[model samples]
Target: MDYIQMRQKRFLIAAWAFMECLLFGGLLYGWGSLMYVFKHEGIYAELCNNNDQAALSAMTNSSSSVTDVTLTNSSEETKLSDSNFKGCPEQDSKFTLCFTIASALVCASSAVLGQINFMFGTRVTRLISMIIFVGGSLMLAFVSKEIPWLIFPGLSLLAAGGLPLLVTNTQVSNLFGKGSSSIVGLLCGGFDMSSAVQMVVKIAYESGISRQHSYYFLTALHSLVLVSTFIFLPKDFILNEEAMSTNIEVAGDVNVTTELPIELKERGDVVNEKTGGLKENNYEKKELPTLMSCVRQPLYIMHVFWLCILQLRFYYIIGTLNPYLNRVLNKDDKMVSHFTNICFYIMMGGLMSSFLTGVVYDWQKRCFASSRSSLRQNLMPAVLPLTIVSFLAVLLSALVLVPVQSLLYLIFIILTLFRSFLYSMAAAFLSAMFPSEYFGLLYGIMILCGGVFGFVQFALFTWAETYVEAPRHTDIFLLCLVLVSFLHPLYQWYRCSRAEKELTQ
Candidate 1:
């Protein structure tokens, strides 16, 4: 395709991918809302019913003077009531396991899928995701209390399948030139916002729509992935500027630099107009680093550390959202549901916040563009976004400790901003710091570490379940961890400044 046509197609594909990801990519993360339906459907209610029976028998055996059993002294603990005992710790734990496993699968599967995409091409990988997502939707559609176990595989498959679309779509951002970082942020935003899918389901279920019918609808909607795989997405990958420039040179389009004038200028290179190949101004292309070499760098290690810490903080909040809300809202069902929906609503704004993060990175690039020859200069742009994300994470961890109910709105806002930048910056850092060829593998491994850290949320949840002050204490602990994340950006800034000084000398 010619330049004009190529640009049009590029936009069309990017928009298509964005919508697809928004609808499916991270839907499982919307567990906050989806948990409501699962509870209504009584997925593990038998466990709760059985526990209630056991508790009733114990209370009958004990003295009538015993008003309440001490269930670990937590504010959210299940109570042994004389008249009725409705707390379902057993049921909630089971559901928590389901979400924990599903969310972990979403991240852990990334490395494997990245390898798959790298080896078999994007089409094959997406085809696999299509199968997994459709099967997951089908399983969820047929799930009932009798088949609660279906939720485990159903949610896991859905999370695993949806992630590929987000992973693959990051490459499409290259088509946008300087605004590519913004597009990366937007794609991450779409993935982040996909959590709203379950919120929509919760809203619909409240409107008298059955869970089965909703998932059935989602199944039908997910089938469009097949269409996207065959029609919209390419067999291999999107051509980035370097790859596209190579193609242009081979196609006899001599004015390669003219076609990408901004990029050419960004590298401090100029081309001859008349001769069509006669000039270069202070630009030298270096050999790309090997994947192993890139991974071994201090910067990469710190980036992974930053991701693991912030990710754990975010996942802990997500995993314990129900109990946390239940405790703070005093178990007011209607109010809890209202706030849960509102949290998802707040998450939808991630698209804007994420896109703005990319804009900030790109603006930083422009600000540092004059010193194109320095490696330190190249690294400076990334530091600002990194620092911003760390700061937001610290703020979120601190805010969760406050007992005031109204502060939840502010907490949710900061949580959304923190999450939006976390994933977007992760992708942006990998793409900018590493070669595109290994982007898939490195990106996957980064998330894999973070995913492993996500399991720690279960331990934290258990503690919160057992202790009266554990939730607040957990927040304080996570705040300390979040504080450590500042070291990554600090080191980056220090390294860059030191390198700049050495160059001047």
Candidate 2:
């Protein structure tokens, strides 16, 4: 969260993600954005299901002349066709089965990693995750041509690294009291910004270089940063100033920064003041709060409820925005290119927000140090007004241009800026709601809620969007914003009251 001190790890994290994205993003997430290459070359697009007969069967459907090829194990003949078929939205119909099956398998790995993070100390887990992340990047750098091979390392490392990222934010929230929202926002914003930057790189490359070469080029380039991270990163964890500290003031009473601690055991590392070194204090573990227990607690419940609502809506709105632009805003090559640029800009803004979130959260902790014990009176008053004003402003400013094109473009730009800032709040604040121990789990729960609501929202909205089209789109987003901002205090008050009652009983 302390940008000047923590910038190295943050940069490595960003660079690591950028490479994974460049390779996989181009293939899947950014596939539509890079359609020309797939349409023309049919390179990795061919589906050769490792079996010789499956390859022969599919090939026979298209031709009599058999192209001789050696078949290996289950992975041998499996390959995607270069044909721009109607079935696959980006590649072809067969790819759907292949992608779905493979994605499911890799996601299983991610789920395992998620569980593992809760068991390890955050720093220890992060160290492991970083290794896995670096390994994944190296894999992508080497295996760009062999697409399936890329999946193994990509998902493996992604799963390994995912929890460490969330846990750090959770720790930040626990350490720094007030502006945790901003810090978490910064992380999320950085994520999206990285995506945006990758999109720009992808767009630029698609205009010139070959797809395989482009992916390889980006992967190799990003991996280059790993060297500096390894060299400069403190060999000893306790020696790192930022990592060891618990409190830092940013400005006035607006922000605070601190390091939250978690022990793998009941007693883990406790620092010796005299020596300025960490000494092992392993102790037997005690029972910790469960999800059910936490939910039954009032404060946690309120925190989760609002997070679910806001995060889901945000995800839903952004998800729909892309296709809506193409479908409604004139689906031309030029417009598509514009939308692509918007993606990059939005992400760039998010990247900047990631750093800013940490700074803002640090500031809030400084402001709220006096009332640290009172959950609502202490915490709510400071952030509630900002949250309300920001949301209302966002709603009013973002939607006004919906009915008009020139204004619409300007509104989109402003909306991107606000989204970067506000979304950072959503993430960091959620982390602030819990103690340090639950950081990874709590953050994951938030994302899980976002994911659930996200799916439902997309389904429902798409069904509704069949009839409703842009002005309606902007209107709905604005309406949701105003409503949430208006009602947050009442809802929060109720939740806070309920929590106090539960504790008393």
1-505, model 1: which lDDT tens digit per residue? 3345546798787788889999999888798887777775656666775576565565566444445555555554554542223237777778788888887887888889999988988889998888989898888888886777998999988899898999887888877887888889989999989999999999998898988889989988887777668776678877667545544433443445322221232343455443333255544333344567667778788999999999888888887788778888976566778899989999999999989889999999998877634555567899999999999998888888886799999989998999999999999988776666677889988888888888887887777767688778888888998899999999988877876676578
In order of appearance, the predictions have TM-scores of 0.86, 0.58
Please name the candidate that would achieve the greatest lDDT relative to the true structure.
1
The TM-score, computed over Cα atoms with residue i paired to residue i, of candidate 2 is 0.58
Provide the overall lDDT of each model, using Cα atoms, as 2-decimal numbers: 0.79, 0.44
Each model's backbone clash number: 0, 41
Error of 1 at 267 (Å): 16
In model 1, residue pairs whose N, Cα or C atoms come closer than 3 Å (at least 3 residues apart or on different chains), thus clashing, are none
Predicted model with the maximum TM-score: 1
Distance from true position, residue 41, model 1, in Å? 1.8
